[model samples]
Target: MTDSESPSGRFRIAISAWEARMSLWIETPTVLDKTTGETLLSFKDGNWSLDAARWLSDSIVELTLRKYPGNHLPVNIIATLDCANRTARIGEKEVQFLAEVESALDNALTWRTVTPPPRAARSGFASAVRRFFFGK
Candidate 1:
């Protein structure tokens, strides 16, 4: 569930990876304001690809928090190929937070929470409509 709809939406994040299992998992609540018409989302590996060896270097850890990326916009992230159950704990967080994106991630083909909120459930009914009519 990306923001219901917004006027000035944006996203940003900073990712510095090393070959290790300690992939940083950052999250925040209420990124969107229904009244403002503006959206902001933060996620891991914004515009950058993560190395599997580095993201999953250690199996013992669950999730780790990293420094915030500060201000930015439209950090479009591509989805991961092999999900490997990387999002089970993320669902746990969404369940705990009762986040808007939980349902979106639940139905996603890839690891839901690792990517940005906009990336979650990116292919929606609108996409199908666009493909059908516009042939995009």
Candidate 2:
């Protein structure tokens, strides 16, 4: 989901259909404290867009699952960041290790665990263009 509520809370995550098959993904989560109104996590991507939100969420879920195979991933893991005034599920009876959860997500992202270059961006168009421009 898009964290647009805070101007500085623009971190994002992304996953692709092809990547889904590989059982991998990517994401960046950022949270802003409601009471103090301070950004708790990094939101580096300023130009991040909504079209990427679905992918981001998917990536985050996949990353989390991959990183912590035995861990039970709650359906509302992401929404938990904004479930209430707290950026984290800290000191909660339900979410025991909120900080650890966030830390794992950051580690996956920081290490570039799953992000591979988009193949479409690498395909050569010069050959096709040459064939179209010249009969040879």
Candidate 3:
């Protein structure tokens, strides 16, 4: 953590875009992993995926592995986040989900970004992967 950041990640969540400062995170306490914070994904056309995955096997089997993640997660649109009220609204829907914020951070790292090393010369496998993907 930086000198300005709290050891326990006690800081406000501020994401500013389009000249707007939206607060999706209050002082709910979260450790900001700079690795994840360095990269962000968006719905821009540049990020579009049009091709379908080709099947490898002719037969499909269902696996009951209790090790997967949830699909219907509580993702707020960030219209307004009232920390005092312990509530947030998603677009026009004012849904009351995640009564406790503790559970949010437990898996927040999964949704965070990882910081990439500087564009300067990097050593080893990471640099190889970067060159392969980024054609640097």
Candidate 4:
């Protein structure tokens, strides 16, 4: 197992690997918030199959989340790599997904009590205009 921090130092990552069935099996890395000591994301009972063939060809890694803090985040994530092209894609909404993950982590660390938006505000602009015109 190896532990490291993201370049930004906002996240700590832990990874473990071993050999099995003639392949190198790597446990999906766990991600934690650096400041709060909270697990933002984790995976278990799953591993990446790294064989010589996979290294030379296309490959896919499926990850199952052991700890996911947000409703918006996925319990399962799929990452595909085009080894020939040296390109990769993980999940559908890459940017939005990362934003949601960070938001979930930030929410977990927030100390203040958050109040929901007022009902009128939640109803949307058209409803607010109607309420103003009808005095309802």
Q: In model 4, what lDDT does residue 106 have?
A: 30
lDDT of each: 0.30, 0.34, 0.29, 0.42
> Could you give candidate 1's per-residue lDDT for residues 1-136 as a string of tens digits?
1111112322112233333235543332222233433332234233222222112222111222222342222232222211122222332332222232334332332332444556444388998898799986
Q: Per model, how many backbone clashes are there?
A: 6, 4, 5, 0
Ranking by lDDT: 4, 2, 1, 3
What residue pairs clash in candidate 4, if any at all?
A: none
Ranking by TM-score: 4, 2, 3, 1
Tell me how many residue pairs clash in candidate 2.
Answer: 4
**Against the hidden true structure, what lDDT does model 1 obtain?**
0.30
Question: Which candidate achieves the best lDDT against the true structure?
Answer: 4
- Judged by whole-model lDDT over C-alpha atoms, candidate 4 comes out at 0.42
Q: How close to the true structure is residue 23 of candidate 1, measured as C-alpha lDDT?
A: 58
Per-model TM against the reference: 0.18, 0.26, 0.20, 0.34
The window of 10 residues in a row where model 1 has the poorest summed lDDT is: 1-10
Task: List, residue by residue over 7-68, the lDDT tens digit for candidate 2.
Answer: 33333323222222265332344443454555444434321112222223311211122222
> Which lDDT tens digits does candidate 4 get at residues 32-127?
566677665443334432111112221222223222222333333444333223233454433233324323333333233468877744377887
- Checking candidate 3 for backbone clashes, the offending pairs are 35-113, 35-114, 35-115, 36-113, 36-114
